[model samples]
Target: MAIHRWRFVGIFILLAILGGAAMVMWNFIGLLLVSFAMAYIIYPLAGYFSGGNRKAGRKYLTACLSSVLLVALPVIYIMIYSLNVILQWLIENFGMIQSGSFTEGLKSGLDSAGFGVVSERLGSELGRLISSATDALWTQVTQPTWFLETSISLALFFVATFYFLYEGPRLMELIKKHIPTREKFLHELMSTIDKIFYGLFIGHLLTSVIIAGLAAVGFWAILRPPLITLGFLVGMMFVVSFLPLIGPWLMYVPMGLWYMALLPGGTMPGILILIYGSLMLTIVPDFYIRPKLVRRDADIHPLLILLGFFGGPFVMGFKGIIIGPLVLGLAQAIVMLYIEKRHILEDLFKRL
Candidate 1:
């Protein structure tokens, strides 16, 4: 009896120590989670590469290639293209971006909106904010410490991601082995999570890709910003997919405003882009296309997904967005499992 009690105490102590360590490393936890999430997102590619044969060496090689294809290659292209666009924009419009014309235009818009007082306040606030930000940026440019820290963090992020991708399946299996519950229940929950993850991530990715292509074509005819930059912004709409109904508009409307308010002879094209984008890209794709894609992959309600998307970011910052939907999915799976085990639905139907 004493030996059993001591063993229990030892286990408890170990858990306490681990929990403390986890708390201490909470900041890095986000990086770890991001790596794991990336691994999960690209697991299908890894599987395809393995061709149903699970050799450790092959799995690692496949994981590396998958990461390169999905992440590294795209990022490199985006960076190169985006930097060129940015440099060109600065060369052409450095005077505009840094001048009072921008502020005067914004103030005029605010006055037209019957918010002259707000405009005055906004101007003052923006002046102060820009002053402080410029000073901070100058300091950072003159200093090397922050740059080094950022570089180290970025390196760690990639290293962690590489390992997570390579060992993700093994890690998941190990996690399942230790789940303190009936294997069936655990399996069901995991399966549900898998479905939800794929539904949200892949649905967002596909929709964003389509929207980016459309936006690139649309912007080619209007919106003076580089096609790549505009398309990149459109693609990044997936970041705000939690607020689905309004998110795309948040991007497109601003883009339209940039053209209308900034460039001469841009208002008509800007208005057209706004109307067309809101209708075709934002509404049709979000409400109709996205629902079909997500629902096909995961047996979840659209409203529930919206709630998870919105609520997650509110509660847990960015991580909450992913975690919120996952938690909701897990809860749903548990409820379904309980209903199945107890025949709750059948009982309710009979009673009715």
Candidate 2:
């Protein structure tokens, strides 16, 4: 009895410590989850690179390389490219604003519309608003605290990814050993989770690639942007498509409008791109290809999977993309497992 009391006391102390840790590290939870998901998705690549070698050094090397190649490099490139593009656009627009051309044009348009008296006031207010926004943006960018936090988060993410990739198999075995559940039930749960991950990561990634490739071709044929610039833009669109309610249309539509408005004889190409993007980039891949690929691996309904993709982000911001589907998929798995073992459950209930 004394030993049992000590055991209970130990468990209570452990729980308290864990709860405190969770509260303290709450901000990092999303980054860790993302790291785990990335590690899971790229584990196969690490395995492939290992080539049957079970040596610890080989495992570490393969895991590190896989994390860098499959996750880190792409993310770094995207961040740098996006920042450069944004800076260039801001510089050009700032020049225009400083020259008074943009405000003058707006004021002239307002005057022609018979609002001459209000034009000056509106232009002045707009300029002030723009200046305030620019200042705010600069201030945010230059904040040392923000930069430090972001750098730490990114560093933790990469380190976590590498650790998970190297330790995944052992971690799974440890979980299996510790979980006090029937082996069959545990196996089924793991299987269900695996299928969900496959459906979310592999299906979505393939669909994005196909759509982005088509977009790149369409952009080249229609807009005639430089090849390198076209690739970067299309690549950015591919990443952006993962966000809820924003997809390739975020790029193509704006480009189409710019082409129609700014360039002579550009109307037909712009119209063609809008039509092409609607059919090829957005409609077909989203409705048909994505669903088909997801359903191939995940036994859950495609509509539910789609809901997870869109709804996860809505509920949990960016991380919802993985977490939302995972939660719903786990629920589905539990229901199916219960159905499969209803008789056993019924007999147990009767005994109780």
Candidate 3:
């Protein structure tokens, strides 16, 4: 009994040590998880190009092209373009914003718009927030360690993402073979993931691009928002509009208010167009494009998409935006399938 007790304590000690080690290495683990998610999102296209193990050379080429064109370029473009727009906007408006009269003008405009109390509160909050952010930004810029760490993380992320995309299929096959689940259940799970991700990654990508272009053009043509800055903002909103407690309405409402402030006299037509344009961009994509594309590709219900998407971030944080819905959909599907296979409903009805 004494020897057995010693063995048990030793085992737990070893387990605790391993768990501590894992916790220390969690950032790298998280990066790998993110890489895997990205690779999974693009895997279907990679598989299509591979085409039944035609040639390794062909597979590599296709993966490279897909990663660059679909993932890399759009990301680079959004970041660089958005940064330039921000810098320019700041340079143009920095002095104006700092002026006392400009603050008074803004307050008067807010008063006119029936937001006097809220505006006062918001102004103080924004001032404090901005001051803190400026200090943080300066510290980060001056800190060599922060820059070095950031660079290393980015390097690791890209390298991991590349390899994951390039060799994801073989790894997946290995994983599936080793996964300790019945073949039928495993197949069902994979099927669910494929359907969910296909709709999520590819469908959302195309829809966001279309909506972004539409928003940029509409703002430029109708409301005449500073094309470069506001255009990018409107477009970026769609990409992240699915986030919980956030949406395009946040951006558009402020934008509409600003438009009114800029031209309080002749703003009625622009306001109408802004309203109409907002509806076109926000409503059409959520209702028509996303559902249509997702359903066409995955044959999943639109309600699942809504629940998984909007409800995901609340439960899962940013990544939960994808994983949350996927988990929910998978669980729901698996339960339904299990019940159907066992005649659970029929048995319950008979009992009733």
Candidate 4:
């Protein structure tokens, strides 16, 4: 027992040292991981298609892929279209509130509210800010095509995903050849990642989509930006929304700022006040509901899940959110493995 415990500590120390030494080789490690994550995601899809066999499986495989392609292609097209429309809208209205009359009116309103001195300070700040912002905005407006081209990452992501699905089994077997099988480490690793990727992580992603859809409709009905575009933007924030304060707040702050900025000049001040006041009341309920919905369904501790999420970025680089839970899952699996090993060893010793 003592020797085993010391061996565990020694192995942990050795791993830490090796990991630190490998930091310079991070890019190569990153590519390898991306391939693994992609293959891991795809293997099940292929298995589902192949029916775990070489016969009578290609037809099911084709049918599955056809269905996926049918839905995915149109959705991607619409997202691109909506993104273009919203970018155009912002370009058209970017400078609406930067004129002198608007500033003077805003100052007068602040004066009436007993914030005249504060308003002057804000006016100076606004002047400096808008000057920089306007230049940036003009550059962005003139390059809408460049903006669209940036979505190529999304294209890469889905394409990689598709290839992973098709070629996963061959890839995994190849990987197993390079890794040891004495501990079934590859199987254990996959088992851990499968739960994190397909279980809790997928649940959060789906929930983010639902929340964004609901929010866009709610905001459009009330605040009324380019409805489809705003919904899609907010929906996409699910990518970052789990991070707290920074995530959801990033989307909402813009929603409010734009609500006022885009309104009629005569009413801009009134709208700004209303927007801020309503957000102060509504934002709490908005963020509070999402976690409750997700955690309740997953039956996982919120703190546990949150810690896993924060720890993900540090450990797994970009894939940490998916990888974080896998790390935790593997830790649990390792503990179980050790316990089983201890039991078998004890039984063998007694028989001897």
Candidate 5:
């Protein structure tokens, strides 16, 4: 019995060591996945180049060319340009504007809407509060540190994308080799991941394009910044919405406020309306559009989304929510299947 216990302990230690090794080695695999994601995103464009070539037999060279020149080059350029834009915007307008105090603004607007001398006093107090908030914001930011960080992150992404594009097939084969073929649970898990990610990948791109088009139209109809560039930036943010929860809100709230402020207002009421409208428009896509598109792959509730978004980062870091849920879901599916197959429902639900 002692000898058997020792053997089990030895096996557990070996598995732990292997897990540590895999964690350390994950960078290479991560790069491969990132490249696949990049290539998948631009596959349509690559298809344009390879579509004719497919008519005869098969031409992978067309795909390679399109991926390298069309997908890779453009994406790398955009990443660099975006990094620069972010750095520049930070440097230039570190605090050229602020929202001031919402409480104060509300008080003043209410007073103007009519409440006599009491309202005027409240508005005056609110003005001071807003002034205090805005006054604290005006300052010069040292941007070199920001530029350095941006430079490093983009450089890594570029390097990863480069190698990924360079060695795509071997990675796919490696993935296929590891995936369980015969198990019903494993097969279903694989199916869910492939279906969900593919839909999410395409649906997100379409959503971003649609949102950007709306933003551009709204901007052109009324605002300053150049259309093409602003549209691209906003569209990029919309794409980032794939991350869930805070990502969409972060992108929209500031822009919505900015648009409202820019609207020929001091009219206050109109600005309030605009702010409310923009917020509604921005928030609607997640509830309405995402439900239909993402429902197929992941039947995750919004509460689960919040937990995943927060808990994932705490446990596993930036991309954790994506990786964590995929893993947990697979395990859950496997366990559930086993329970059903063995007619172990009473045991399973009781445990739950």
Candidate 6:
């Protein structure tokens, strides 16, 4: 068969177009990846809501509901609650500073330590710092460009998520149809990827829940923060726990320090809470249970999953949580395929 000369030209043009499109979309890569991941995670829920219906309206509605339930509501709740708690704490503390209570307390403590001379200067400096910080925060938050950009990004994210959920299966079928691969190998590869996704997301979620539960119980028993406040804080911790390195410690450590330094007769409870958090919240669940769960579901080594969890953020920021495990999991899958079909692969290579 004679090769068509224009076919090479067509291929070159297609490649150039794809490269240009990729460059244009590079800034939104994180947003798109997150949307895809969210859609993948919630697809089963979408399926359940659709009840095997193929109607476009039904699929769209189900995708919308699933995205909101699985992603939006929880994210909004965490952000709002965390911000409220932080703002409340700042307001109360600022009130104390304005009322001279905080400065008076600092002065008295400094006088006892022979540092009274510097207390006034320190208080004034702190007040100035807080004022400047508040001004800067207000300025940034009020920026029209920032607000517009954020709004647009959010809109795009939801749209992408909805379509991904609605069209994912069809897209997969289309891809499978075009890909030049044996059905069995492709199925195995896809199944492996699915298992890894399940292991990473579900395992992390369950670990967070378990840690949050432990934190709530510990707070109720030991620290004794207000019930509603404790719940809110624990919920925030649940979200933060998904991140590497910075977990419930963000809440517990500060609370521990506050207990030890601010409250009378709180040193013991503070120490106890710290110990409880370290052992129950951080060490056990994160290190042992999480990896075990991931290993069980993924059928990949716990060590690899752990590396992906911890090392991904270091390498690729937040998305690495998904990407790291996925990359490692894919590498594992490829190796396994090579091992299982070594003879065939070698024979093919020899023929080539």
lDDT of 5 by residue, 162-239 (tens): 445434445656777787564444455455555545554455544544555555555445444653457455665654
Q: Which candidate leads in lDDT?
A: 2
User: How many clashes does each candidate structure show, in the order listed?
Assistant: 0, 0, 0, 0, 0, 0
A best-first ranking of the candidates according to their lDDT comes to 2, 6, 1, 3, 4, 5
Candidate 5: deviation at residue 37, Å? 3.1
Name the candidate, 1 or 3, with the larger lDDT value: 1
Better of 2 and 3 by TM-score: 2
Clashing pairs in 5: none
**The 10-residue segment with the lowest total lDDT in model 6:** 107-116
How much lDDT does candidate 3 score?
0.64
Segments of candidate 2 deviating more than 4 angstroms: 1-8, 52-55, 63-67, 91-139, 177-182, 209-221, 224-264, 271-318, 340-352
Candidate 4 lDDT over 87-130, as tens digits, reads: 67656645664555545656676566555479877766665676
Cα error of candidate 1 at position 22, Å:
1.4
- Give the least accurate 10-residue stretch of model 4, judged by summed lDDT: 293-302
Residues 108-208, candidate 6: write the lDDT tens digits: 76555444578677756666666566556556666879767766887788788878777777887787787666445556666667776666566665577
* lDDT tens digits, residue span 141-247, model 2: 76879767767888888898888777777777787788656445556667667786676566665567678878888888877885547867887878666544567
* Candidate 3 residue spans exceeding 4 A from truth: 1-21, 44-58, 80-109, 112-114, 178-182, 199-210, 220-232, 243-262, 265-280, 283-288, 296-352
**Candidate 1 wrongly placed segments (more than 4 Å):** 1-5, 50-54, 76-105, 108-143, 172-183, 209-217, 226-236, 239-242, 247-264, 271-318, 336-352
Please provide TM-scores, in order, for all candidate models, with all chains considered together: 0.67, 0.68, 0.65, 0.50, 0.53, 0.63
Q: Which is superior by TM-score, 5 or 6?
A: 6
Question: Which model is ahead, 3 or 6, in terms of lDDT?
Answer: 6
